[model samples]
Target: FMMKGVTPGPLLFQEQMPLIWILFGTFLIANVLLLPTVGLLTARIAGTALRLPFNLLLPIIAAACVTGAYAINNNPLDVGIMVLMGVVALMLRRGGFPLAQVVLGMVLGPILEQHFMVSAIKSNWDPLSFFERPIALILMGACVATVILGIIAHKRRLTGGDESS
Candidate 1:
C-alpha cells in the first residue's frame, strides 16, 4: 500500500539523490505489481480463514508468532519478548483497551524521541525551537486533536452512544 525507498542509513550514503530516486522507482514498481496478490490474499484470509474458532486457531497463531520471532535472529530472547508482549496485549484487549494506540506508541515513541533529540541538538539545546517551526506546530496540533477525538469516541462507546464515529 506504500513505498519506502530510502531507509535510515548513514547521511553520507543517502546523499546520492539519483540513486535514492532510482530505488524509490524500483520500490514503487514492485509494490504496484504485488498489490493485487496482497489484496486478494488479505481478503481471502479475512473473509474465511479468520472466522475459525479461537480455541482451534489460537495455538496455531501463537506458534507462528513465536516461530517468526525466533526466525528474526535465531534468539530465544526475541521469542520470550514476543510471548510476553502477546500476553500483555491479550490482557489489554480483555480490559477494553485499544491496542492500536499502544502499538503506535511503541513503534513511534523511539522515532519521535530521536527526532526531538536531533532537533534540540541542531537548535543548541533550545527546547522552545520545537514550537517555532510551522510544520512542527501543525503536527503537534494534529496529535492533540487525534488524542481528543479518540478520548471522545471511547467515552461515547462506553456510554452506549454512537460507535461509528
Candidate 2:
C-alpha cells in the first residue's frame, strides 16, 4: 500500500518507514499505551462521572443507525431489514448461538460468491474443471487440511487435552 501511495491516514505517517509498517507499529504502541490508560479510566469511571443517561445515547445511536441505513439504499426497506436482522440475531443469541458465525458469514459471503462465480464462468460451467486447476486444487487441499486439523483438535479436547497446553 505504501508503494502504491495508499496509506491509511496521517496518524501512520513516518519519515523513514513505509506507511504500512508505520501504521502497524503505531497500532501496537497505541494498544500498549491504552492498557494502562483503560485501567485507570475504568477505575475512575467506576468511582464517579460515568453516569451517562440512556435518554441521550439511545437517540444518538438510533440516528446513526438510521443514517447508515439511508446511506446504503435510501430506502426504508433497508432499515426494516436491519431491524429484522437485529431481532433475529437477538433470538439466535437467546437460543445459545453466538452472533460471530452470522457476522462472519455476512462479511465473507460476497467474496466467496464472487470467486465461485468467476471459477464457474471461467470453466464454462464445468465444475470438475475447478478442481483440475492448480490454484483451485491448492485451495481445496488447504480447506480439507483445515477441517481435518479442526476435527483432530476437537477430538483431543474431548479426550481431556489441556486447553492451555
Q: On a 0 to 100 scale, what is the lDDT of residue 74 in model 2?
A: 90
lDDT of each: 0.87, 0.84
Which residue pairs clash within candidate 2? none
Model 1 residue pairs with clashes: none
Q: For each candidate, give its TM-score against the true structure.
A: 0.59, 0.55
Superposition-based RMSD of candidate 1 using all C-alpha atoms, in angstroms = 8.2
**RMSD, one per candidate, in order:** 8.2, 8.7
Q: In candidate 1, what residue range of length 10 has the lowest lDDT sum?
A: 1-10
Candidate 1, 107-138: lDDT as tens digits: 99999999888988999998888899899899
Clashes of each: 0, 0
Please give the lDDT score for candidate 2.
0.84
Badly placed stretches (over 4 Å) of model 2 are 1-55, 162-165
